[model samples]
Target chain A: MNIFVFVKRVPDTESKIRIDHKANKIIKDGLNFVLSPYDEYAVEEALRLREAHGGKVTVFSVGADEVNIILKKCLAMGADEAVLLKDDTPETYDGLRTAKIIAKVLKDKFMDYDLLLFGRLSIGADNGQVQTMVAQLLDLPQINVVTKLEIEGNQGTAYREIEGASEKVAFSLPAVLSAQKGLNEPRYETLKGIMMAKRKEIPVLPLEDLGMSAEELAPLMEVVNLESPPPRKAGTVFEGEAEAAAKKLAQFLHEEAKVI
Target chain B: MVLVFIEVREGKVKKSSLEALSEGKRRADDLGAELHAVLIGHELDELAPECFSFGATKVHVLESTLLSQYSPSGFSRALKELVEELKPMVIFFAASSMGKDLAPRLAAWLNVGLATDCTETGIKDGRLTVVRPIFAGNVFATMVFKASPQIATLRPNVFPLVDPVDAKGEAAKKNVEITEDQVKDAVQEIMREEGSELDVTEAEILISGGRGLKGPENFNLLRELASILPRSAVGASRSAVDSGWIDHQNQVGQTGKTVSPNLYMAFGISGAIQHVAGMSSSKVIVAVNKDPDAPILKLADFGVVGDLFKVIPPLKEELKKIFAD
Candidate 1:
């Protein structure tokens, strides 16, 4: 029951996001990067599966050198191994292109895996396409936004949330599942685990080594511009009796807001 | 022609799909392209008239028993066959849970690019360009496809649904071949919450609570207010969800659902950047909190510096009176 979890490093959700209009990229100065919150659930699930099934949990991430930090964090949280599929290209945040590279790597190597895991979406680009694309490329069964998962023998059952209901899906081994919130509470790294993780070196595989040309790996989607949403102006604040404030707010909504 | 994929649940078309079809109609008119709709399932031709009223000039029904329930492989394969045959210029899908799951698989099958959760779409230089919120609505990225049959998923409730008008249209039924082997994943059951309340993403107005709600039992107050308003739903902040005070489906924030409703009323919520990222696109925002300096007060169109427990009763009464008029 070998498990493969794909992880990503993204700017902390609390951090202020600023765009570099000249470069058409995000400004990286003085921003604290952390493992994507959703991916934490994936890594935790993988570790638990490995513990119960008596196998290894290997984590994969495709990004530049900065991504290694997240890979190391996964190792600190009890992952057996970490691999970085390095991408130094100027084109950033293409889900299809990234999926192609990963699919190629998985096809060429690591053919004996029984499970593939991914965070539902990365916080930065928020595409939520790569895992499904990878699953399609590899021709594997997939279930996204899974909340509860159970594995027995060579089969797996997962419960995924929809708008007003939850679907119970069953699939065979070698399937892909994307983690959503409430999957599980991820554990923090222990002192011993951190010390052991610091001594491990993650192997890096460049995109060029995957035998795909720049044109083949090129992004099919173009980013025209990146900018902040229009600023929202702060309107009047009523400070006084609760009843008066409530009445005034209702008046504003009726005449000015008119939402009701 | 532009193709819009329609999703049906329990024989009824989803509201988000209608919204996507309406948007597709607008884009199709702008580009002078025919608007067509596709539904992949059994016994769906009966729903074609609804699609026509919304703006689809033609509805393509890909009927297959294997596709009666949604399997990522089965539905994507069926849609893939249709796309290859029609070769439409573009494809549109509502960014619902089904759309989020199926569109990418189809895009991958065609080896084409897809933009997800787009807020705006139009023809630019004779190709489709879209605007999508990235970094959780903190920033907007304008995107364009580099290949033919450009695909995108429009965010639910963000796009306006047009009034249905009678239009001359036809439904073309095709029998798609999908074998049992192709659908390795099976849906055993669908567990719906009692009464099937509206999802927050599709709600017109939201009554959201935060830590100030105190406990899980306090959520009933928000639910009471939501019930009083038409097309309203309850939402929760990250703190409230993290504390096990509510379900994740009701959570609205960066890690939760991004919602753009007509009116958003936040109670006892001190806006964090992540939470604000989800609701900033809301049309009108009002906040009630005892803390005058809560960040939500700054972003809200109207702020009340008072106790929410005290304010909500009067607020509900005032709203009831206004609606009575």
Candidate 2:
């Protein structure tokens, strides 16, 4: 089984995001970047599949040169190789253009893969569109938010969490599956793994190499404006004995909220 | 025409889809276009009238055994075909699990732009603009789609449902074509959570706990409180679910479940933006945490600084008394 996983570098969840009003962009200074949490699960699932099925796992990402740090982390987690599709444009591409680029690369450059893995969604954009878009672009069956998966021969069965229920789906091979939480616990990189990762070389592919032009990758949607959500009005905060606080809370709920 | 996808399960239209229909109706009226609804499921002919009452000028019905359960390929293909024939200026879908999975595929197949989890939408300069929360709920970005037939998935509960009115004499119903072979992915079964009631997305009141509860056993206190509140459901932060304190189905956060309950009460949850994104739209928010500066308190309408163990027991007792009265 040849498994390919797509990873993205996003701001750490705990990082404080500041919008640069003048520039109309997020200020990246003084911010920490990490492999998207959901992508870590995707990389881990790929490694586990490779270990069980006796094949190589290659990690791929679409970003600038700074994404090498995240690719190295994937290598440390037992991926056999890494590929970075360097975006020439300064602006972020929408899901359609991004998926098109990835699909082109997979179809024209790395054609050996039998399965593709992706995080359910990236926290930055939070659009959760690329994986499904990639599946559609490639005409491959796809499942999103998969929590449990099993594979045998050329068929796969996946369990995905829906609103109040779970669904069991069966699909053919060469499919795209997005990893959700509870799929499996990702293993941390060891000292030896980290040392080995430093020695691994990641090839950065340019848009020209993938037969794509800058204009072809332009975003379909334009950002009009961005603003911080208005702060909630200050409310009464009780600081007293547990009983008094509870009594106060009950009174507020009944009188103000009126849910009771 | 502006088209809205009316999601149905077990032969009933979903509340979120109704909200989407209401949004679609508003946009259609604004654009002076007809509002159309698409219903896909087995035995959904009976539910088509609900769409008309919700302001659909026309209803498109596609019934097939293959569509009884949602398959991304199946639904997207059918919808794509219908969309091509209809040539709608805008399409609306509820940002439920099925919509989130299907909308992107349809957008990609049509080579159009899609905005997901939109809290607000409107027409500007004869184009569709959507406002969606990013970085969880800390920042809001307004986006405009340059492509024709713009697609958007509206967050549930954000839009008001249209007041029920008499059906405008049965909407013009038309049947779309879809064959079983078009559905590539097969669903073996849909396993529902045993003895679970009120999914967080639809719950009117939610009582959520975080890691401060100390252990999974402590969730019983939340359950006891929930039992007394009508239509209330239990929710957990990602931290609690990650720590195995509760099932992921009950998780309320960016990656878990986005909800807008009538009232949301957080216990020991430090309001992470991820958690806040899911429930910040609650009509009323109450928080209890030992730390005064927990992020959730900033968003709550009422806050208490105390240990949850001490506060919850008494709070539940007080709530029982108030409700009893």
Candidate 3:
């Protein structure tokens, strides 16, 4: 078995997000970048699968040069190899364009892989479209938001959470699966693993080397403007004993809000 | 034609689909095009009338046992055939789990652009433009599609479901073709959580907790409150779910569930943007936290600065009294 995992670098969840309205983009200065939290689950699941079934885990990411930091983290946590699909252009926001580039690379280079893994959704764009698009491009079976998975021989079973139900689905080998929460607990990188990762070299693949031109990778959608959400005004705040506040709240619900 | 996919579960239409229908109808009127709906499921003949009442000019029904449950390959192939024949100007889907899974695959199959979880949609300069949240709902991105039959998935509860009005034209039903072999992924079973309790997305009132609750045992406080309120459900922030204090199904956030309950009450939640993206569309929000500066309080319609342990018990007691009377 061979596993390929896609990782993304995003601002830490705790970091404050600021929008540059004048430039129609997010302010990247002074923000801490880390591996997307959900992708950590994917990386960990890949390592576990390697342990269960003899295989090598290759982690892939597409971004600027700074994305190597996240690739190193994945390597330290047990990924056997890291590849960076470099995209330094301004048109990287289009999910389909990104998916097309990845599908091209996968087809040209790693077509023999048995499985592809991805986070259920990237926290930064929240698009959740690229992995499925890639699966379609590859014409392979795919499942999203999988909570539980089991593989035996050439077949695999996955459980995905729906609105109020869970669907148990089975597919053959050479498939795409997105990791949801509860898939597994991501382990922290150990000292020995970190030291070992320092000796590994990550290969960067540029679009030019992949024989893709800028016209082919151009985005279909343009960002009209980027703005912060309208500030939510502070509503009336009550300060008093718990009982009095509760009474006032109940009154407000029944009278003003009329929700109760 | 502007086509909207009417999602059905257990032989009934979903509220999110109704919302998408309403939005699609508005967009169709703006474009002076007919609004059509497609229902793909088993035993869906009875569900077409509701689609007509909700403003579908024509309802397409593709009934097959293979589509009784969602399979990416089956539904997308069925819809792809319909889309290729109709050549619709736009397509709409609810950004639910099933819709999120199906829309992109269809878009990729058709080689078109797709926007997911769109909060707003309209026609600009003779092209469709959609607005969606990015960076965990902290920033909004407005996007335009470059191809015809542009596809978009709408966030549930973001659009209004207007009253069912009489249709101008009778809804014509058309049968679509699908084969069992088209569905590559076989469904072994669909296990629903054993209960009659409403899920968070379907609940009208939601009481959610965060790490501030101290521990998993404290979730009982929220369950107690939920029991007292009508059609209420308990929810948790991602931190609580990550801490193993609650089930992921009960988690409400960017990665979890996006809910727009009638009233959302947060207990000890600091209101991270990821969590806010899920529940910000609720009709009204009330926050209770010890810290006066919690981000949730800023978005809440009402705030009480106090310890949740002290406030929740009394609050539940007061609500129980009112209901008893």
**Which candidate number would show the highest TM-score if scored against the true structure?**
1
lDDT of 1 by residue, A118-237 (tens): 999999889999999999999999999999999999999999989878999999989999999989999999999889889999999987788987776879899989999998987889
Best first by DockQ, ranked? 1, 2, 3
Considering TM-score, which of the candidate structures 1 and 3 is the better prediction for this target? 1
Stretches > 4 Å off in candidate 1: none
Candidates ranked, most accurate by TM-score first:
1, 2, 3
**Alpha-carbon shift of residue B218 in model 1 (angstroms):** 1.4
Q: What's the residue-level lDDT of B166 in candidate 2?
A: 85
lDDT of 3 at A122: 83
Clashing pairs in 1: none
Question: Candidate 2: TM-score?
Answer: 0.96
- TM-score against truth, every candidate: 0.98, 0.96, 0.95
Per candidate, chain B TM-score? 0.98, 0.93, 0.92
Give each candidate's interface RMSD in Å. 1.2, 1.7, 1.9
Candidate 3 lDDT over A191-218, as tens digits, reads 9889888889999998778898776687
lDDT of each candidate versus the true structure: 0.91, 0.87, 0.86
Between prediction 1 and prediction 2, the one with superior lDDT is: 1
Number of the predicted model whose DockQ against the real structure is largest: 1
Runs in model 2 deviating more than 4 A are A91-93, A213-215, B169-181, B321-325
